[model samples]
Target chain A: MSDKRNSETLPLAWIMPGALLLLWQASSSLGWLSANILPAPLSVLASAWTLTLDGTLPHNLGVSAARAVAGLLIGGGIGFGLGLLTGLSRISERLLDPTLQMVRNVPHLALIPMVIIWFGIEEEARLFLVALGVFFPIYLNTLHGIRNVDPQLIEMGRVYGMSPRRLFRRVILPGALPSILVGLRYALGIMWLTLIVAETIAAKSGIGHMAMNAREFMRTDIVVLSILIYALLGKLADSATKALERRFLRWNPAYRR
Target chain B: MSKNNGAALTLSQVTKRFGDTPVLHGIDLSIAPGSFVAIIGKSGCGKSTLLRVILGLEPASGGSVASDSDAAHARLIFQEPRLLPWASVAANVAVGLGERGDGPDGAAAARQALADVGLTGKADDWPSTLSGGQRQRVALARALVSNPTLLALDEPLGALDALTRIEMQSLLENVWQAQGFTALLVTHDVGEAVALADRVLLIDAGRVTLDQPIYLPRPRRRGDPAFAALEGAILERLLDASVSAGSR
Candidate 1:
């Protein structure tokens, strides 16, 4: 009975999108909507196909993905390291936390103009923007995760005479890992968002660049295709992170399913 | 270097203070090696604090607590299981090994410890999957895995159901006998103190008010007249101490 239900409803989530696409096709066929304003889904698909055949879509998609990953690694690594440092040491917290808190308040997007002035419209500016956008969530969550680990477990570690390093590895790190993964998931969301905006503003290549370039040509179909590509990529990145979380946090009862 | 049978722990005028509040007031006691001793007291009566001081989780403000062996060769089982939730049951138990090499050798020892605690097939299971009683058993495995010379339990079985608590008491005593570690259990349960300990220490207001020995043999029965007598005696001692403190 459960198997039958699973088969019946598992793809139920696709029904709405399918219905919307069908509605879009009917409206376009009946000439009820202007194609220039909002391209039909079929036209968008056709544009995607042509772009793929010409190697334009795949190349730009690759570039965007690479930039997103690079920014994530750079920002995520620094955030995680600093979080551990500040969380572990009172001296570090006192020294660096105030500066970080102040900086965290100013919107990261507002720095795009300054970033352009500093790094110009180069790839570095895009990377920096995405990195800055990704950093705070990872840093804040990592700090919270470490600081909130059960003190009882810490005492248990001490009772067993674990060295400081071992205590961090066996007790503190594993205890804080679920929260860190949560931060990573949030960071991934910000990574794509920042990259799209930065790329749209100034970029030689990438899906965001393609969308902006298509806007000038009034190629609404191509622009729609780029948006779809961004949506797919974001979903893909989210699913991958969720899979990683499942693997790492399987021992957590809350994450059992 | 000798594994002498008596007084593995010696406390000399040990005093612990939390800022202005003195929690342990010039307390002195001795605990024998290879024996089970229980410390019983009312809540906030410094029983747990005394265990912490003995375990060196906190330093005493005055005097000394010396273990006969290396301080590193000691372990504590807390009131809660306190298992590392992210680790497998075996890995959590293996944590008892403490900085020891952790590959196959540690795993084998962990498995053996689990078997000793009657959790032979649960080494790979996560702590979250275990029932409360099972989790505490895993904790016991962790405590015993290191082969520590001194094992301190701070109301370790307090959270367990009565039946599970009784089962754990037998398991604890059997393991203590087999391992021959000097065991110190701090608990509020007078019956528990009488059932398990070779000697029971009653504390009130940071002082050891009564130090009594239980001559009851192994596999002690709660229904036994002598067992009931001992529990009654310890209860009276605690009550008398509180009454005197109230009067003073």
Candidate 2:
């Protein structure tokens, strides 16, 4: 019954977007909308099909995806490690949190110029920018999660004679996971946003670069296709995080349904 | 159900203070093995604080809190279930076993513990899925899974409604009888202390002012005049303590 209700409403969600696409297609085909400004959705699809056949789309997509994953691993790993450090130890939090808080306030995008100069427009530059963009949300959320774990539960763990490591593993980590996963989903959005801005400025190959290259030749179709690709990739990232949440937090009622 | 010998506890002039404020002032008490004792007091009367010190969650600034059982064989159930939200009920129950819980045998032990609390077929259920009373039962199971010689319960049923509180009091009595753990329950309710405890201690002004023994037999009926009289006397004593403390 729930499945039937979902199937009915899920189609309703698509109606507005479908209508907009149809309106755009009709206006472009009737010459009311010019190709130079915004090409019809079909022409964008055609460009995507052509790019796919030539292998450029897949190759660039793969490159961009690799960068996102690599940056997430490096940045997210460090953020988690640092979050643990500060969360578990008051001394560590006192020593490091203030500096991190100050640095966190500065927009990560503003560091791009310095990053380019330091890495000389190499892959490191884009990776560093993307990684920097992804780091703090995960870090802050992790710290908040750990610090806010019910103290009563920790006291119960102690009274039950749980070893320090076991207490952390069984109680603290799982307690913090819901918040950390929230950070991850937020970071995924930044992953694509950071990559888009990063790639457009520096990189030789990626969907962003394809759009940048298309701009000089006035191929508005490819530009629109690139934006669409980013949109689809962002949606894909959200779905993947939702899958992870379902797997990791099956015990949580919010995630179960 | 397998029963273990309950641990004997002896507190010799145990004093605990946080900063300048005194919580427990030279508390001296001896708990015999295989006995059920309830600690009852008004709010902020330090009964819960004493329970924490006895359970070793907090240290006594002076004197000693000693138990015959191994420190590993002691467990506490808080007012909240304190179950790991991300863990299944069986896994949460297994947490009582400490390091032993990591082993395969712990699985069967956890299931048995669940059954001990009449929580059959709920081993895999999340704490979030259970009712308040059921979750508290799971907390009881977790404390029981280790076959604890000393069990500390700090107002474990304080949040439940009246009917569930009565249900849990019987469950508590049954478990204490079967397992023979030295049960130390800290509660605010006079009737609960009378119903479940072999002896009830009332604290006021940071001291055990009234140490009363309830001579009523097992499965004592709440409707009995004897039960009501005992409850009323204790309630009067508690009110008297709080009122005098307020005047002072």
Candidate 3:
């Protein structure tokens, strides 16, 4: 039954990735692909092991992680706050939504040059770009979710004598939660992308910087290891969000574990 | 818990307009405390609007509406159950208690209400898991949980199948009898009106064309001669109004 499938889901997921890794190792060991272009999986693992021993991998990873978390907190908090404001008040929406929509259409990474000019390659430069990247999806989705909540349900809440605060907490927030989670997932993706681009373009001490340094030295193994780290982090972020969805949206059959 | 909880409401010259279109025109009526009153009309005849205007859901354009109970003590059962989809049945029922809905005492009251509605085992279930009839029962429990002084029912059983509707009607009658709250039901079914209400008001073209009082005993039989007669008379008037409107 579904229980059995649930138990096997993790193993089932790793099967394809495991096979791909083996095939990649075989190709690299046989010299079918040159080491200059692509390093073997084992060599990448060896490089990762060395980086860990030297404290480079963990240090760069911690820095990248801290940046990502800070950006998410700053951007998501502001976006959600603004979304609640604009979604509830028509006057706020009229005043702010147009400007937000215009900014949303621009590729956030394209602001890299201007951001560097403003912050002079400081941590703020990277933080600004990543936060900007994470802002729109969360904001737009939050606003849309709030606006589309069933009006009838809201009316029912009011009739049931729910005060203004309880009305939002009990009715509006839960109703908009599913959509807001979706926005978080989208913003997570943009978070990684913005971080990678920003780190490569500026004086950075993160995974992207490590990869850039390896590329200059033609250490393709270390470079591939950094790429894999980004991939792993993205997967981890997605799983964390899914866990949150399961916890918060368990009342919804679609989200019930 | 007693008939003292029943809310008597009175409205005079109640009028409602949406933009240029008028939905209700000068509706005037008084509901006695603890009495079950059913309002019947064809679709768009403004029976629902009249109920809403009195309940303050839709503000009357011009009128005086007076109720013994404050708006907080009034509960409405919409045609759709309107249960919070993300909350459990118990939690949704507890919503009738407002801010205390998540508190332990509210949960206890919600369980009692659910038991009253014969849904004692489904408190943890989601609204999506319930049948349509069960969902409406949950809505009823939620409305009853707060011990409302006035309960406004807007064709609450209109969408149920015939058998479930009858079962729900009997349940409603039982709850009204036990709770002693003022019940205002709006429906198109003459049989339902006859079977449930102390008085049946017939509305046509935004006016109360008829107000017939029922002297039937508790748990009135739909097959009884008096019930049949009242149902028939209302049906005849309703059909006549429909025909007259069509021709015009």
Candidate 4:
């Protein structure tokens, strides 16, 4: 019965997408659905091919990728430093936590207008938006990771006469790594989302800009292709992050299993 | 060096209390170096507290503890293995050495320590994958890796099952004989105390009431008459304390 169920479900997963494509092709051929609003899947694939052949896809992808990477590094670095400080020191936590909480409560997207006013609709403004989006999750998780380290392990380190630096490096950091990785994964996703949003509003060239330009020209095929590309990029980023997480947390029971 | 060969722990007029309730009354005791001292007491008698104070993990309200302070690198084996769940068996054992930066050489030392505990084959295994007994063996290897002057044990085998506990007791004996470090074990089991220690100290109401030497030879069996007699005598002292507490 289980094998039968598995065999039935296996085809259903493939069939759903196949049936949708067939319906889309039939509707477009019969002129039931207008190409202006929803272009046929074949047309979207053709536009994707044209964009790739003309190097437009690679250029836009490179711009977005570079921006995302830079923003992640800057934001992740600051978040990790501040999070470790606040987590390890009670005084630092008392001094910074309330102010950070209040600031973090404000939606980062809401600050785009102010950011544009300050830095203009330049690269700086877009980078700032991506960084802001990346910061919160990494900071929160790093702090959680540090705070959750076992007190017994700390005592063991002390008893062994470990210097403060050695204790942090050998015991505290490894103990907190699993949570920090979780934060990194979360922050990466938000970084991409914020990057696209920022690019869509003001950027001259990027996937998001491409989608916007396609919409203006009523090139629904290009827009659909760009959306598909964005989805693929997000999935690729997530899978890479997962691979890194597994590599680092190999000793963790959950990862081992 | 000769004077340091016997167990010597000196606690001068120690009095400990938690809030208004006194746990250990004014107490003074000196143990010779190299002596295997087992402290046995009923729950709430402050035996564990006494061990903690000796280890400098806790402070006594009144009294000073003077040991060979230069021998500051004492190792403790807890009731639970307390192995770091995130570290492999080898890495956990090597934690005592801190970050030596010697790489393969330091790893070899860790391997040797695990081998001493008969865990060489399981060096790369995580603590979670190991059985309760194996985890305790890993903990024992961790403690031994430091070559500590003082080995403090707080019911280290109290959680093991009967068969495993006995096996661990033998392992402890073998390791103790091989290393010859001064050991202070806290236990509620009178039989365990008699079986393991050169001398047993019975604490009742936070005060040492009995300090008896066990002259029984090494490799003493639990079923032996000498071991049974010592166990009975410790049991009697514990019962006498309870009876006195009731009369009070």
Candidate 5:
């Protein structure tokens, strides 16, 4: 059924996006919208080319990518660890879950002003913002995954005289992996968005900084180019994570395709 | 061999109650070593509960149940395969050995067990890819790998289609003959009970209402008079219980 649907819809996926791009170009050429505020696709391409040749595009991209990756690693690690603890140990859940829930309810983005004030608009502030954004989704999903594992499987393990550590390692961890992977993917996307926002507000150089600087000079072409780069980066990160997920969860039914 | 002294299992005055209702009321039974015993009854007759008690999965409400064998004396094969979705076929089978790092010989033992179930080639395959019959075979292999002294099957073939059910029945008998482990099977299928068991124990409302020996020979034909007679007797007992319940 999925095969038939994929084959039937394959052409439309390409054609729809192509048609949208053509319509945007036509509108801009016909002056339906001002090119100053919304640059033509060609103008954006030209600005992107110029920026690439000058090495500024690559430099800013590297800065943004590094910050996002760093934040994801730290935040995802901490979240996964804590999530496992809360999911497996009732004591840990009772001790930490209420406080975490209260803190999670407060939007991490709302702490931007305080974070900047505390960390002084440096790399620390930007990274911390990205980490904070990535943390909650991963943590919550991990906890959910661990909690939802089949009780039957756990009983089977116990009947086999499996040690507590072995039961957790062999059954609980693998059972929770799919959910944990979902959390990781969600956290990575949020990490990128948060980094962009943070860099736009305070960074000296990064894709977000480039977009902000272009806005200041009314270089709408550069702004559009930077936004395109952001979109592409987000797609690339998502695809990479999906590839890793496939490798790890090859036995999963969802990953069969 | 002094076979008379080898008591396989004994459940003495096993009384189980749930809340205010009694399930197994002072039930007592003794199984000899290397015997195939079938417990047949209608649903909610507490046959499955008896198997669970024997497996140590559930505690008895009253009286004591004991196995002459060691702690790893018996293993259960549930109606569903219940294979771990994430583990490979070999890993699932090896899980029977618990968490004792069985060194390098573990893989070989797992493979041998799978071979016993005619699934040697599919060792690395995941449970998701397996058919219903294949999954049940893996479950059987998992139970067998432990070399259990007593095998408790809780309607293990109940979920299979007719053709698959017959095939699994034959495979189970073959495995049982080869291993020679004492088995207590709880099944709703009367023909299955007569085919596999040397003795049939019929339970109703958690008590053993009937204990009859099956004198049918090995390689018993389903169409034979003796097989049909046993099947009819068990069916009549079950229907009688249902009718009694209805009349009440």
Candidate 6:
């Protein structure tokens, strides 16, 4: 019965997007909309198809994906390590927390000029930008998760004579996982946003670069297609994280359903 | 279930203080191995503090807290189940085994512990899915699975309904009998102290004022004449201590 309900509701989700697409197509065909301002959905798809055939779209997309993944790994590793350090140790928190807080307050994107000057208008600059943007949310959320683990459970773990390593593996890590995952999901969003801004401003390759090149030639179709691709990528990232959350946190009461 | 003979716990002038305020004042007691001892007191009378000192969770301000040098280990059960919501009941039970739990035998021992608690079929269930009574039972299974020589219960059934509390008391008694672990229970209930403990100690104003032994046979009922008499004597001591405290 629930499956039937889900099937019925699934089509409803498409209705609004479908209607908008129909309106876009009608306006373009009727000349009610200028082609340069916004290309029809069908024209964007056709251009995207052509780009796919020529391998330009796929190649740029692959470059952007690699950059995003690399930045996430670097930033996530640093954030998780520092978070554990600060969360578990007062000494570490005292030594490192204030510096991180001060840096976190500075808008990461604003550092783009400095980054470009230091690293040049190369892939390094974009990767650095993405990594900086992805770092803090994960750090803060992980710290919050670790700090919030119930003291009672920790006491029980100690009373049971658990060694420090076992205590962390069995108790602290699992307790902090839900919050860490939340941070990761948030970081994924910042990851794409940072990459887009970085690539659009300065890059020879990638989806953002593709869109910027399209603007120079007034190929609005490709521009619209690129934007749609980003939207699709963001949606895909979100769904992937949600799947991960379900798999890892099935033991959590809130996630059981 | 190993029957350890003679004193399992030795407290020599064990005193605990939070800064200047002393919670346990020169507490000296000896608990025999494989015996059940309950400490009873009003809230803030330091019964819980004594248990914490005995379990080595808290340091004594003065004096020493020692157990049998050869005792295998000690485990504590709190009023709350304190189960990890992110772990299954079986996994939570396995936690009691300490480092031994990370091995393959942990799962098998957890299964057996769950069976001992009469929760054989619910090993895979989440703690959230279990009722309050059932959760406490799981806590028991977790504590018992380690096969500790000493079990420290700090108001382990304080949150249960009267009926569930009575049932749990029996369950605790039977486990204590079978496991032959040194059981030290701290509670506020007079009847419960008399019902489950082989010896009862009353704490008041940071001291043990009364230490009485109960020689009643097993399956002691709350309504039995001997049970009521023992309960009344402890209650009278508590009342006398409070009266003296109030006047002082």
User: Could you give the TM-score of chain B for each candidate, in order?
Assistant: 0.95, 0.97, 0.97, 0.93, 0.95, 0.95
Give the range of the ten consecutive residues with the poorest summed lDDT in model 3 chain A: A195-204
> Each model's TM-score?
0.95, 0.96, 0.95, 0.91, 0.89, 0.96
Instruction: List the pairs of residues colliding in candidate 1.
Output: B7-B32
Docking class of 5: medium
lDDT tens digits by residue: candidate 5, B139-196: 9999888788888898999999999999999999988888888988999998999999
Q: Which candidate is the best by DockQ?
A: 2
Error of 4 at A220 (Å): 0.8
**TM-score of the candidate numbered 1?**
0.95
Question: Across residues A1-257, which tens digit of lDDT does each residue of candidate 2 receive?
Answer: 88999999999999999999899999999999999999999999999999999999999999999999999998988999999999999999999999999999999999888988899778998889888888998999899999999898888787777778988998899999999999999999998999999999988999999999999999999999999999999999999999999999999999998
Error of 2 at B225 (Å): 2.3
Off by over 4 Å in 3: A5-16, B1-5
Every model: iRMSD: 1.1, 1.1, 1.2, 1.8, 1.2, 1.4
Query: Model 1 chain A, poorest ten-residue lDDT window?
Result: A248-257
Model 1, residue A74: displacement in angstroms?
1.6
lDDT of 1 by residue, B158-231 (tens): 99999999999999988887878889999989999888999999888899989999999988999999999889
lDDT of 4 by residue, B8-111 (tens): 67999887888998988877988777778999988878998888888787778999888864445577888988787877889888876666523776688788
Model 4 chain A is weakest, by summed lDDT over 10 consecutive residues, at A248-257
| Winner of 2 and 3 under TM-score | 2
List candidate 6 segments past 4 Å from native: A1-4, B1-7, B69-72
Evaluate model 5: give its lDDT: 0.87
Which scores higher on lDDT, 2 or 4? 2
TM-score, model 3 to reference? 0.95
| Root-mean-square deviation per candidate | 2.2, 1.6, 1.9, 3.3, 3.4, 1.7
